[model samples]
Target chain A: MQQDAARLKVTHEGDIVQVEFTSRKILDEANIAEIGDQLSALVEAEHRPRLVISFAGVDHLSSAALGTLITINNKVKNRDGQLRLCNINPQIFEVFLITKLNTLFHIYPTIKEALESLRSGAQTGRLQ
Target chain B: MRPVFARVVTGTLMKHLKLQAGSRGRRESREKSVGLWCSEEFPSQMAEGRRVEEKILSQCRKYAYGQRDLFALKLALEEAICNAIRHGNKSTPNKHVRVKYRITRERIDVMVEDEGSGFDPAVLPDPTADQNLERACGRGVLLMRAYMNNVVFNSVGNSVMLTKFNESYSSSDTPINSTTVAFG
Candidate 1:
């Protein structure tokens, strides 16, 4: 399955950190339902300005993905950090539009844009 | 052709024909019946029911004839099926939940049956109240009633049958399509 090859890579650059959770479709909600608590613990430990969600591997998303993203963002904000999504595939983007969640959080075409915006302090609620 | 290969080819062709014929019959039957039927084993063959629900939504949304009505049906069906899995059977493997869907000219019908002991449907706490909104739980059953045109609990809460009506069907006489399914 696509999720079997998925990875959540964690890397840091001097107080700047990027943690990405990559997954495929069947891994969508069941993954969140299973790992949400683990994500909560991880968010509680980090203090950073940006979190990147590489949607390169995702096939489809649903209300569960939206809810999970929102919950994680809340957890990050509690730690004074923000969540950014990057490399969103077309199928998942369609869902984002359908749900009108494109308005909820920062999104970028690539990780470079996300990091650059964060460093430049273009602080905003959500970017299309 | 090799005997085994020939058999395999014939078998696959027959299966494809059966499925194609089944699809046609199902479409024709649904014109009047508007019902979905399958065995409890269907869930085990698949991972979860929500994905199935979404597929059904996309397939049947046009039949709903209105976006809001479509959305309501989607939400109500999700809650009903989720409850059938979570609350009714508590997601227990030992228990089987059977779902049957039917839509008449006016009303949509969904019947959910679980193998577990029944409960009182009346005692569910209201999730819309101020105190319950943020808890992230307890809203499934209430939302079912909110979106469905009607809700009925059988002799016990082990089974629930939900119904919704299209306003058009009520105002004008709707012709029921009469067809029996053929799968050969």
Candidate 2:
């Protein structure tokens, strides 16, 4: 489940589209757009709309990557779907905690926790 | 010989102190530093650092492990290597980069040399200035000066010589830096 160049693997189950971010350097202003645009196109093409990003492989996320995910989350909400993050590595999760983006996004422990919430009709703390 | 001619010759000779900067970074075991040579044009710059830096770190750590100088040594070396790739060679594959590490009892010296004709290192604008604040570049020079005890550009700036004073013997007074320059 490796995609050739962008260093991410995407998998889908029902309406939930999973995106995993991977790169050697900490995500910052430099290469964030290269990953963001790819995710954007995948979102626009898929009508089902739910997104669960498995952030296990990411080492660090700068402000730019955090903002990109936030923008995508807004777009998903406007479409009446959900955007969540799962399997966040502890290092990157600490970065999110430091930035307080953890307060904004619905973060779950696993992909199943994120997807099952969508299917069961209960909510996970109302997106923050 | 005139006193001024003798004086001129004496001072010019004295500045480049022969503090014995020879011997490889290896302690007695003599394993060469890794990920350091012929890797300027790799597909990813950070990837190159991760591959080489770990090996270089391990080589030094075997001898100088837990010596407080490890992190700064690793960071400054990577930044210098990265700067050689980005600023020196401009990421061009044709150019070659050579990195050599020499560890003396009192200091560790890391030299990064590039094939390109070097620039005047002094002319580089301060990166912390307003216009350059957001730039991803120029931060390496700052880190090198901060981490290394003395940094010198040699062989016409084609190479950077960075030396970190060993922790145990390094003094706050810095006896080598106390000389005053007097010009009327």
Candidate 3:
């Protein structure tokens, strides 16, 4: 197969990196691996990375994708960074709830809230 | 009426076996009872796995399955096929994963088998556990059971069967309490 195109759209706002997925479904193994690598690179570039991942248009994702997110979360934590997820659709959010990942990651309903939470150093709008 | 089976082999090592039952006189009854049945075998490649998954999902779309049902099946199918390819087959060059499924208006049943030594699902650590929450893997089976109506493993653990009832979307809304696992 040919090489995968960039899967993430990354933009930097001050010290925070805002990322979005170009593909609506992140279920493919190769694509997930590529996304993981890209996210890792971003995390490594910052002394204390502050990232917000928006799942605005993503319709589907697999356990492998979730695993990648968790790995990214760990990398950020190790560097004393922060990661926030926002705009997750109801179905996907239920996936988090089922795995109890809703409690592990800081999730917000909008990118504004996530950015604010990161800037304020205070978590908010976490789903119960 | 007896069931008729037709098999077709493609260049990509994908084999499709379609089944239909009934005589000309019993067509209506057969349509009601048999629905659609398909079995396929493909190489242990993610692209091949996805091709087969889309075929199955297209059938669901043809039947006008609800959005929630589509989401549930899509998630469950991805996990099942991924597990079979990556873990069961270990991504061996020549290893193949076989998918057999039956779809009716009321429910869908899928079985995925791989050519490798299987592991016991009972021993998998709970990904939701605090100690394991940060772990980067092992949530596939949990998500499968959560989305599908039933998930069963074979006695040797190499094959798993997943079932979901079409009109039973309410069950998926229930909070995760316990998973139903059976060995056959």
Which candidate should be chosen as best, given TM-score against the real structure?
Answer: 3
TM-scores for all candidates: the values are 0.51, 0.46, 0.84
Judge candidate 1 at residue A62 and give its lDDT: 41
User: For model 1 chain A, where is the 10-residue window of minimal lDDT?
Assistant: A1-10
Model 1: per-residue Cα lDDT at residue B74? 64
- Which candidate ranks first by DockQ, i.e. highest? 3
Predicted structure with the largest lDDT when compared to the true one: 3
Error of 1 at B53 (Å): 7.8
Candidate 2 segments exceeding 4 Å error? A1-128, B1-51, B104-106, B168-184
The DockQ values of the predictions, listed in order, are: 0.06, 0.11, 0.84
TM-score of chain B of each: 0.63, 0.62, 0.75
True contacts kept of each: 0.00, 0.00, 0.95
B11-77 in candidate 2: lDDT tens per residue? 3322332221112222321222111121222322445544555655676665564445665676577
Q: What is the interface RMSD of each candidate, in Å?
A: 6.3, 8.9, 0.6
lDDT of each: 0.57, 0.58, 0.81
lDDT computed for candidate 3: 0.81
Please provide, for model 2 over A31-56, each residue's C-alpha lDDT reduced to its tens digit, 9 standing for 90 to 100. 66677777776678666587888777
